[model samples]
Target: MTRQSRAHLTDRGAPTSRPVSGPADHPVPATARFRTFRVAAFALIVLVIGGAAIGLVVTRLLGPGATDVAAIQVHASMGGFDPPALTVKAGQPVKIEFASMDSSMHTDGGGWHQFAIDALGINWKVGPLASEVFEFTAPATAGSYSWYCDICCGGKANPQMQGTLTVTG
Candidate 1:
């Protein structure tokens, strides 16, 4: 309970004593200081590593995946789309050949354009005349599916560039 002073060597290599503030006014033991620092560092490392692992796992689980079927393509041209109606097997892949009939009259500088097909959880998107392919696993539960030009080229009128893929099981 008595106030004790801490002793240390000064820059001149001479012994010196300075007044200390805690328990008996003595400097804390080196072992206790090292133990506290070690514990804190270990905890920080564990937390950082744990967080990264969780993030990595979540990303893998939620990201997109490749469907079992093959790819299909369709063509879009000026005025309308070729093969306005398409038929595909129930559980296979169909490729659509996207060709531009008249580049001089099509929107987007009289050339091909790009758009996305965001339905049925399928990520099908490609550029004009670029031959993009999308795969439908199986008949999509036996129903009619419509694909349209997401691009705003139609203005106030219907783009007439849309098409339908009928899945037959």
Candidate 2:
């Protein structure tokens, strides 16, 4: 090609004075951009405050160490309930927290344990390595009920896995 032809070919792709940058290249005035930034900052502040309020509400409603009522802790494992028994007054509302210690991967309900009783209508099944809290009202009749871990470790037949919930007047 001739020298003039080469020069024309190179000049065809040269850049112009118009910037190729983002939003800055848009011809909006400084005041308009500042207003957009102010709006975004205000929205962020509102979101943060709203999130903090929600968190505080949730913490107050479900946080541990409830002091208003009688509470008891019951732990479960491959062996049995920690105390192997529990006692409560008839018709009294009680909080029972069940904590599962071991993860039973080889059993039917893997890593899960249960405290079930048909008489008092209580059946609490907890996931492996986790804990759960529930409320219960003792039977008004006042008698002994069989509670057992009928999951993973063994059924009610296993003496070690069974316990008695004795309700008294």
Candidate 3:
């Protein structure tokens, strides 16, 4: 075969310069690029919205701010309040945040658990799966005062549901 013919026909008689298209030959148009960007932006917005929803749910489940006025958290269940003992300075401002861990009882009317310190004239109640805050001033007289839950489990009579509050001068 002549050199020119040999160059044009591979031993198999196939053309060397077959027509083919690459990415550069078919450039993406401005509108298509904009649509792609819009889709990506929409996906990002969805992700952010979903994340925020999850955050709100988690926050609700975990409970709200720890911030308070002389905040103290007391939990009450069938077994009664945990940390039955508390201490404070005489005449000091005090705040108790009460939460009922009891799921068995309904709290639509206040709650099943009541915290009362007769001497301090403080009485507060919270229902199942609920919380409440109480603010008071410690008794002026420095002494050990009794506190108790007056509800389902028992009152001041039930040792398990009763606690002490000590006021120091």
Error of 1 at 111 (Å): 2.6
lDDT of each: 0.52, 0.72, 0.71
Kindly list the per-residue Cα lDDT of model 1 for residues 1-169, writing each as its tens digit: 2222222322223335643434443344545667999999999999999999998667433322223234333456545555667776777655544544333334553545433344655444444334444444645456777666544356214557576767787
Instruction: For model 3, give the 10-residue run with minimal summed lDDT.
Output: 20-29
Q: TM-score: which is higher, 1 or 3?
A: 3
**Which regions in candidate 3 have their CA more than 4 angstroms from the true location?**
1-70, 104-111
Q: How accurate is candidate 1 locally (lDDT)?
A: 0.52
Backbone collision tally, model 2: 0
TM-score for predicted model 2 compared with the true structure: 0.56
Mind giving the per-residue lDDT tens digits that candidate 3 earns over 70-104? 57988776666677888999998988888776553
The alpha-carbon lDDT assigned to residue 42 of candidate 3 equals 99
lDDT of 2 by residue, 1-169 (tens): 5545644544454367644455443334445668999999999999999999998667433333333334577777776777798888999887888877665453756767788998767889888666788888777778888888887645777887888889998
- Which candidate has the top score in lDDT? 2
Ordered list by TM-score, greatest first = 3, 2, 1
